[model samples]
Target: MSNGNEAGDRLRVGSAPDSWGVWFPEDDQQTPWQRFLDEVSDAGYRWIELGPYGYLPTDPHRLRDELARRELTLSAGTCFTAFHRGDVWEQTWAHVRQVADLTSALGARHVVVIPEMWRDPASGEQLEDRSLGDGSWRALGTGIDRLAKALHEEYGVHLQFHPHADSHVDTQQHVERFLEMTDPELVTLCLDTGHISYCGGDNLELIRKYPDRIGYLHLKQVDPRVLAEVQEQDLPFGPAVRRGVMCEPPQGTPALEPIIEATRGLDADLFAIVEQDLYPCAPDVPLPIAKRTREFLNRCGAGAR
Candidate 1:
């Protein structure tokens, strides 16, 4: 984690190896995980983040072997439904612990948690009963604090909270509140550009406001027109995603200069993971998107930091 002023300040650019990497269901045409590794490697990526959905070996030895065979390093992985609307805390904790063990075995450190929605699954109604306020924040903070301590002491892993569209904590205000309530040392922010922008937030301002808490980054780009449509239609998260509002890196809509500038001097350990929520429609998206993002960042002298 070198500053921009440092002689060697190359911002390591990599692809998030989730659905965006292989296009999930459509990726079935190719061999499971090996083909993904091969394709990404061929596309010129030495590192990749694993999505929750993929052919990842639960066993450490096999996972390490697979990574070695592909010459790829595990940059990070998703902690699915960990904080999401599920009553599987004990189960999720075990699963996350296993992921932590896997990460340690593979020599990676960061785990991204996408919080669950406190909504009704039946009619897609927003649930107001279990909403978090001051008291709930205290309880949530306690839970996260305990979890963070366990992760640090047991596995030496860092927990990065990813605020996402439709999730409980997605907006800039929600992020700020979470940061204010939670233990900064235990829980850090995964500043996702597209999510923030989609929520009508100024990504640069948030980054500047909490530079130290930025644990990792999801370098996504959004289409301004699509964003406009989302707003005009007053579409919720599901419909918005279905309408192709969110997109790949190197935004075809809004300019990404501000984002690059915002992250220019960041010194904390960062994984600028190129995450394009799009996959099924655009199968061969991640490689080119990644290449373009890295080049753009490099041009902006983002690699200087």
Candidate 2:
């Protein structure tokens, strides 16, 4: 194992807006956009991934000014698209292009894609064990490859496929199968520690098994008790997240030390973006955790130095 106290020379730390509890404008009086950016800066984060589009200013100049004020650079932007079906991608491609243009203008190099579902999260749909037909699987791979190449060649953004908990590639076997179908050179894994763990995959093992395939990361930690509840009660993705399943680094299963250790010797520019999916919660709840998480990464010897 790579030393947890000295996690190699290249690994750098960053964060996402989900860590700050501002997923959407859920509350009447939500936290200000500047507040999240300020806290990210105050917490010593040098990079941040754009959460949902329009969560931050969609206008490139305004967004650039906002980030420049905080000394934060755009790490990447998340694009949750249903790339499995061709017609869906036609509608979603516009959103992807907008985000790609924005991220590229901001000098962010990654375009993170999550395969999406149409069902309601509140419906408690269990998708982890599902499998697609052979032709559907091939179409999925082809779609990802095409999107990856287009995003890379046209937008100057590398495409990273995030195997999320509620997505088609939820389980370890599914993630393995997805990678097997796609071009390794075209599609890279945007590993999410919490989602992988929540879906019953070993994040550490996956990182070790495919070091070369990992191009980006969501440094999320999953609560073991919360995951147990999710499994036992058939909880939906939103409810599981709202249950504080993905929390600060020190308070979770698959302990972050080992996970962080597993990330050594990958690409130098890889962004281990800290992402705790806080939903419908107070901004106060995440502020202290953000500070502690950054400090914790530094102490663990995994953060930007």
Query: Best candidate, TM-score-wise?
Result: 2
lDDT of 1 by residue, 65-182 (tens): 8778777788776775533333446876887787787777788888887776554322336655435656555656566666777788898888888887766676788888888877
TM-score per candidate, chains pooled: 0.82, 0.92
Clashes of 1: 3
Model 2 residue 148 distance off true place after TM-score fit, in angstroms: 0.4
Model 1 earns a TM-score of 0.82
Each prediction's total of clashing residue pairs, residues at least 3 apart in sequence or on different chains, is: 3, 0
Which residue runs does candidate 2 get wrong by more than 4 Å? 1-8, 25-30, 122-130
* Model 2 C-alpha lDDT per residue in residues 1-305, reported as the tens digit of each score: 23344463456688888787765534443567778899889888889988878778889999999999889999898888765655566777788998899999999989989887534454556544355777777778888888898898898889999988777789999999998888988889999888888889988778777878888878888888888888898777888877878877788866776667766656545678888888767768878888888888777677574
